[model samples]
Target: MTTHFWLNETRPARQAGAPENRVYVRQYGNGRAILLAVHGFGRSGARMERLGLQLGDQFTTLAPDLPYHGKTEWYDDRYTPREFSRILQQLLDRYPDRPVFLMGHSLGGRYLSSCLAGLEHPDLRDLVLVAPDGAGGRYTNWIDTLPSMLVRPLARISERPRSILRLSGWLSKRGIINRYSAEYLKSNLNDRPFRRRIAGTLRSVLKFPPRAEAFERALQRHAMVCTVFVGDRDPLLHHDRLQSIYGPLPSVALHHYSGSHWLPERLLGEYYRNSLLTTVP
Candidate 1:
């Protein structure tokens, strides 16, 4: 069955000097409960529309295209958690009186984690992370080692030597790297503007990596409920790693599923019903 919802196609004007983020929001229902859904890297809010629709009975879901993806425009070449946090704050301001329950996947989850660590928002009620990236792991450790100052310059350099990106694709074809990894590398290399945006994003994240201790502190400070879902075979993050990183936190609960980086639609629907619905009331 086809569902009807409102789509705001206009690009909203952002403050001067800040990144121009034209948020394309897909709204479902007008329920009393508020929900803000964020999508992963390389994905748009349109991806989260299904999950939002599934939970329409319980919430008014606001899924917006994040900066640099989908219909959103990012005029500033630099992207950092602080800048992204400001964008989030603007979105939150739209619903000043309501507490928002946040659900994010992959990169989206990382953004939420960063916000919880550094920003203070009294209206943020709870959090749900699906295969989140900012949590401690080998990937995060590698990110921690990089110098943020060098990232943008390196991105520029890589653009000139297009061979580097082509070589990455060749390596993927030769089975040196997994197909998923290879495609991701090639996509960035082919798109110069996106590559620069990605560089800025990485630079910001590396400059201010999320601290597990800080996440715990924030959760305690806000008395927020957090639920984490991890796929057992997720190429990006494994369930075991999630356990090691977030297991000790009293406010966070972890659930494992038999899937990969992307959970089955049935499982995702059930998650919304079981986790979000139960938490709201």
Candidate 2:
């Protein structure tokens, strides 16, 4: 049987009260270890599927669509912490004995950090962050850290064309958001439906600030093997920012690529080592 393929699925919530917990995942491969891959902002699970495809020989990748971006249904007033935990549990529960690895890209890094903050699975062995967020990057701004009551109104700023354009422009000018993010916002807010979708993603982003200290502490507690892959020219993911987040732990490897925000997939393949994996944690 060919284990190297892709599968798209939307699994329903098992718990009766958790109807909002349905999750959509794009899975690839059937290797011994399981990889839970998270994608960047303004992207679906398909983006992470690209990286997962490269590591499929050694790892089976489970990339889930974050709420507001894909098939996942979420229209809540707030995107609470551990919001996806149940769905994650549902996915990983199938492979009880497999050593699980975590990988996140850009904004997905923050989601990964939030996931690890309370997840207690010992089989989790490694974390691969590619141009990830929550490394003390520019995104942890006051606007995003607002109280829940205030955040809904803040996210609604994206509802109107003028307000969102001005906001993105202001964020770019203040360096609170990346150039790509600013550009994406400017170009995509024309349609009302897309604007609504953008509002929800913005709300989710606002709800989860940088959990760096919490994430780092969790990594130490779990003794997780961590490797951060960054592009040298990626303005959003700088060397100093990453060093600040992972420098205390000498075990963490920081690999810098000679490129831009989009890392070369071939280089990522070069660094994947199954030797680093232990027997189910």
Error of 1 at 263 (Å): 4.8
The 10 consecutive residues of candidate 1 with the worst lDDT sum are 1-10
List all candidate RMSDs to the true structure. 4.6, 4.2
**TM-score winner:** 2
In candidate 2, stretches whose alpha carbon ends up further than 4 angstroms from where it belongs are: 1-21, 136-151, 170-180, 274-281
For each candidate, what TM-score against the reference?
0.78, 0.81
- lDDT tens digits by residue: candidate 1, 1-281: 22333233233446655534445666776656677778876687778666666766766787777666777765654466666666666667677777678887887887788787655566677788888876733334444554656554544555453754775566567754456655666666667666655555554556446567778888888788788888777777745656878898888999878887773557766765665556555
Please list all clashing residue pairs in model 2, or write none if there are none: none
| Counted clashes in each candidate structure | 0, 0
Q: After superposition, how far is residue 92 of candidate 2 from its true place, in Å?
A: 2.2
For model 2, the local distance difference test gives: 0.68
